[model samples]
Target: MRIDKLHTIDSTNSYLKRISKEEDAQEDIVVWALEQTAGRGQMGTTWSAESGKNLTFSVFRKVKRITISEQFYALMAASLAVKDVLSKLLIKNVRVKWPNDILTDNDKICGILIESVIKRGKLDAMILGVGLNVNQTEWKDTPRATSIKSRTGIHFELEEILSMLLKQFHHYVDLLLKGQFETIKNDYEQHLFKKDKPATFIASDGTQFVGIIKGVSETGKLILLQEDEVVNEYDLKEIQLLY
Candidate 1:
């Protein structure tokens, strides 16, 4: 694992993508920064890393001989990596929100963005961007955001956090490569949000319904058991999770 550390960048994920075209960077190339001015999240949401108070980094990994259905494995691996790191920091009640959000005590602590570029009927590469709130004690004017420092009143070195994350990420990637999908899937489900509780889901058609989150499908589609008679599976944009 080779890391390219930067003082500041607009977005580590975009930076890696730009350089990936010019140079053939190998798998496990990490790009990290102390600040991200234009950080991005899932569904084109803006991720704001408050200068030196958070962890903003991206990892590029090359994929071969795997179908797109297996891409969720990579996402699960990355989310688990963040979870492992936070667990080591003794962050209590850390859990993964389906698809890719890390939560602690039901508040969001980290966000993950996984982008895949497919060329020639195979996966060319994947950019995994992770943003975690570490030392930010207070979030100014944000709805439902919390940091490790806010929760624990302890500050952590950004470099030390990144190292721990990368170590766990590499280990999980190795597990994926070895075809340990069942193990990863089980662990992911164990940490999933609203695992056995009824929650509201808003569909693309603007209909709201209460359902139990069964788990995600192999292709990363969210599965919901609705009304004890209807089973619905949804893609990313098709459904939104609600309280």
Candidate 2:
């Protein structure tokens, strides 16, 4: 694993993507920025963090043997890694809010954005961008946002947390590489927020409805058990889970 610390960057994910194409980038290349001028979350959402007060970074991983059909494992691996780290830190109720948000006690503490490089209809590599709230306690507009310090009431060293998270990443991604599909999938679902409980959802058409998150589809779509015993799959752009 190679880590490059940047005092400042526009976006660590963007920077790593450019460098991976321009040069020969290896797996586990991490670019951590102290400040991201323009960080992003899933689906073009802006990720705002107080400068130097959180964890904002991206890690590059080279894909092998994992086909496009199995790419959802990447998300599972990364999300599980974050949950693992938070659990180690004694964060209560650590759960993965599907697709990529990490939550504790129904409050968001981290967000992940994954970008992949595909060639010839096969998975090649991916950049996992993570924004984790750390010591920052002040939040404006985003009421559900929380941090490690806020939950634990104890300050943490950013580097120590980063190291622990990266180690978990290595372990989980290795499991994915080793073709432990069922194991990873089961672990991810077990940590899913509201796995069986009824929840409210808003469709892209602005229609609000109720559904139960059963699990995730193989292609990463959300599986919802809806009205009249109906089972449906919705992509990221199709539906939003109302927290």
Candidate 3:
């Protein structure tokens, strides 16, 4: 439960990989940065953080008896951790967008990137990188983007928020190991984007269809109800949710 705070790193996620070969880095060690120059997101996208205005940290945890199929459980835990911290901070309109984006009033406030490092035949460690827009007042002309300070007009201490997030993350991770996926799933569903409403979906072939948001499967596949008769399951990027 001890976090090794690394101040002013280029990127916490990158630093974890740089130090992964060292013998001294232990489990539960967290690498944090006040300013990240080369932060990364899922699929090689650059994660933007305005220096002191956001939360950028990576957590390294050891895992066992879990396959890739269970990776969504870890993501769900992290999403819930953000939700829990924000709720306590009195940020009321927050929700988790499926897979891994945290939103408030339908605007993105956080992004999570989880990477697993497997050595030989067993799981070595998993790196969870979280980027939370905390105190930024303006969002660089990006649509559907927001920050906690912009929404509430109150500034937050990054250190305190980081502490709360780590605690909640560990708690939910324990629930994940206990096979309590339903808890995470239900809570996540409650915050789903356009839940139970007709929405537009753009498939990979550029075909558009109108589907009602149903729910996600246990393995994290998105389920959609099309034409009130056809139900389809989609993996990420296979079907894009049109806002």
- Model 1, 1-243: lDDT tens digits are 778989889999999998887787665688999888899999999998689889899988887745687998889888888998888888999988888899998799999999887888788788999999999877677667899898889988988888888889889978988899989988998889898789988888999888898888888888888885688888889988885
Across residues 104-201, which tens digit of lDDT does each residue of candidate 3 receive? Answer: 87788899998887778666678899999999877675688888788789999999889899889879888877888889888888877787989888
TM-score of 3: 0.92
For all candidates in order, the CA lDDT equals 0.87, 0.91, 0.82
What lDDT does model 2 reach? 0.91
- What C-alpha lDDT, on a 0 to 100 scale, does residue 4 get in candidate 2? 96
Question: Of the candidates shown, which would achieve the greatest TM-score relative to the real structure?
Answer: 2
Model 3 residue 203 lDDT score? 92
Ranking by lDDT: 2, 1, 3
TM-score of each: 0.96, 0.97, 0.92
Q: Single out the weakest 10-residue window by summed lDDT for candidate 1.
A: 20-29
lDDT of model 3 at position 238: 85
Q: For candidate 1, what is the lDDT?
A: 0.87
